[model samples]
Target: MGIRSTLPLCAVVAGTAALQIPLLSPHQQAPLEAADKTKPLINSSALQDLISGDRLFTRAKKLFDIAKLGEDEYNHPTRVIGSAGHEGTLAYIYESILQLGDYYKLDNQSFPAVSGNVFESRLVIGNSVSKSAAPMGLTPPTQNKQPVHGDLVLVENEGCQIGDFPDSVSGNIAFIKRGTCPFGTKSEHAGQKGATAAIVYNYEKDAVQGTLGTPSPNHVATFGLSGKEAGPVLEKLEKKDKVDAIAYIDADVKQIITRNIIAQTSEGDPNNCVMLGAHSDSVAEGPGINDDGSGSISLLEVATQLTKFNVSNCVRFAWWAGEEEGLLGSDYYVATLPEEENIKIRLFMDYDMMASPNFAYQIYNATNAVNPNGSEELRDLYIDWYKDQGLNYTFIPFDGRSDYDGFIRGGIPGGGIATGAEGIKTKEEEKQFGGKAGEWYDHCYHQLCDDLSNVNMTAWIVNTKLIAHSVGTYARSFKGFPKRTSSVASSAYESEAKYHGSMLYI
Candidate 1:
């Protein structure tokens, strides 16, 4: 959850200045040139092998089509490591990987996967107190459902500062902002100040409108409130007025065990690795088929197929558990890695939601601001592949919204493909894509309706095949990475925006 990589790549400048500026010094340029010259290039044999990998697709479809998985099955819930849902999902994935590994002769290892979960809490507003609200993921579960009523402490900035909480906040719930610093930090600070609970309001600058923050590690319950709702409470707190509010942060959530499924090629060395990962967990409320079932199936097929094929790159596959509960499995895996193992990861391809009936395929471009992620060479290679395939995609910045966040933060090159979700398509995009501009890309994105029946098989299958082909291409002949381009300012974004129109939150 903390920031991952400390390695600094060159920052990208824009327009005229960037064009005139040289990125490397004379000495660095020579090494870079020499490295590029010695790198391998993709060969036709690998492409043929990838194209012929039908067994992988068959297996992937089987898992994706099956909807029996609950949060702990193919789809994980909010449970992190040690939760039944988390553990169950992990166990299933682990079994799948073991099967694939044994069949393919790949050396696979299982490590401890763990996460924090809150089991209890108490909220008291005025005279009424009840444990009706459960803290969100990464927030601590309430220690006691004890009713604690006092003046509500509203911290204006997302970061808890000196004046944010007064002494009156003792035995009170502190409301904090969700920008400037991580929500977890602010919540932890409030808890250190003897605050009973924390409510994080979404930052005004955030495009995603919601009051969101991490839970307290010290078992402090945290709630996310909208800016509209938190504003008045903050105003009252600033006035030093006594306020009555109900606070209950308790849940039946319990600790349990979980596992991560992994499969690798027998011929490859673990020292140099290529990882492809996707979480098999879903939100607790729904089946989360498209949210990840699509991705799971895609990777399953890819991994299964890899077991049968012979490739030069050491490829590994992972089906993570507890992704719904704040990336527990992936986080644990990344955190436990030795420095060398972490750096040996040449690329990490994350497939979250690959097939959506409503949205066109959208690739997570590492060059996007949300990610500004991975090695430049990795992104360029993938981008070039997309172009060659004539696939339609929109590049967004890296925001650590998925499992790939861990690898990306660690400075590994990461890129994945996703189809549209809730975002509206622009007019220009509509012209290109020919869909209703302001409709949800996948109406069943996170609901039970997201079963296999809701997915567009053509899209799913095509995209899955594309992923296999792309990965194989990279595995066969990757050399030095491509030049990094930071802060890609696209002239086409406006045109695309005009076509898609504004997002409609239905």
Candidate 2:
């Protein structure tokens, strides 16, 4: 299927530095020779055998290195959308798949998106100027970078609902505690209440690096504060102490062009397609090796191996962009597909953040009321695979935080796997996964420290093997897989669409 878009291109906001790394170096191996048509159909064991942890780590390290090449004075090594690092990542995937000859049909689905980054932020409370202020991504900057001076009004009960923003918050700055809803929702509500700006403080001791999901007219200049930085301010407010502050965020928010890389096997039944995807872009804070680099590399490795054999169903792999800002690429892909093309996608599986340091084999729980009917079957496939391997697995909610959100809402059956991210581990999980309890599954999640060291090689390889098993099994046959139905639960779509990012649930 071809990519047809009516979206107009805009001026690029981020620089595209040329990738200095060679496409095929000594360490970067080429794709295996084309599959012999006479070869046997792909099997789970054979596919699983092709997954190598050493190879996975090598490729992941390559991606990290590419990210570092894009580093600038204003930003860290990151593959955030529209940056040079993400462009290099796109080139690597495209060139790698091209090496396999015409075995797969590649599509460059181009679209426009609003990319933003915070360069400088400040929160001044009297003479005490806190330069540690972190601006929420995609939120508009202070008008012309001028400081917004107003009384700091503490929002009641997390500021999730409109009523939580008191009338006094009008013509002032809303000091909100982070939790229960999206940062975008809080900012939107604050703007609705006529607040000039908003400050959201983390509930934990860690620094806050959050997103407003996407640009909105209702949003005001929003910033994040660490718990420690906001503690005294909160105490003073609680004691009815008069508090006035100046908030300023210098950010570059503008529209830019980005594309999604989609490749489908040329030899399989086009009418029956098995799809797999992962967001290829990282958050601005770091290289994002564990957050999604692991997932992206897993798909690349599996795609490379799949060329050795033929299949009964078309296998489509996608590397999505604009996922860090929100699930923009995937959402656009699903929305633009013709109804005929959409129905051909029998199943869509997502793999994201597969290598948390303190990992657990967590499969998406598709039994939730919001998910489509056939999603449960996909979940069972993963659960059975983990059981066969004698590995313990847990269920994470199939919420609309990732790329799968768009597919499920469009009535396609979707499911996938993840290790974990930012969520605290339980004692039972520690016993099962052999990791510390009461600690984050990924300690360096969305931080500059989320480099190669943050990955769990063992867990990553195991998860990659599972991906191979699922792809091979379904490619051979879909005898027990459910057929696509015409109708979807409307209420389900409404519920799922409300979620924008992973941090929203927290």
On TM-score, the leading prediction is 2
* Residue 346's lDDT in candidate 2: 80
Q: For model 1, how big is the CA root-mean-square deviation?
A: 10.4
**Candidate 2 residue-wise lDDT, 304-352, digit = tens:** 9998887766688999998887788998998888776677778899999
- Can you give the lDDT of residue 219 in candidate 1? 37
lDDT of 1 by residue, 1-506 (tens): 11212231111111211333243221121111111234333343344345332443454445443334334432533222343543444454555655653333222234443344334554454454422323545455455555444456766555446466566666877766665544556666777778877766654422222212323354356665555555555676678776666566544344545556555554433335568888876655455667777677677666655554455555667777766666666766777666645655667887877767766756655563334334445556556666777866667544456777666555556777777766667776666555667777787755556655666666676677777776676555345543223232233322222110111000
Best by lDDT: 2
Cα error, candidate 2, residue 34 (Å): 14
**Model 1 quality (TM-score):** 0.71
Model 1: ten consecutive residues of lowest lDDT: 497-506
> How does each model score on lDDT?
0.54, 0.82
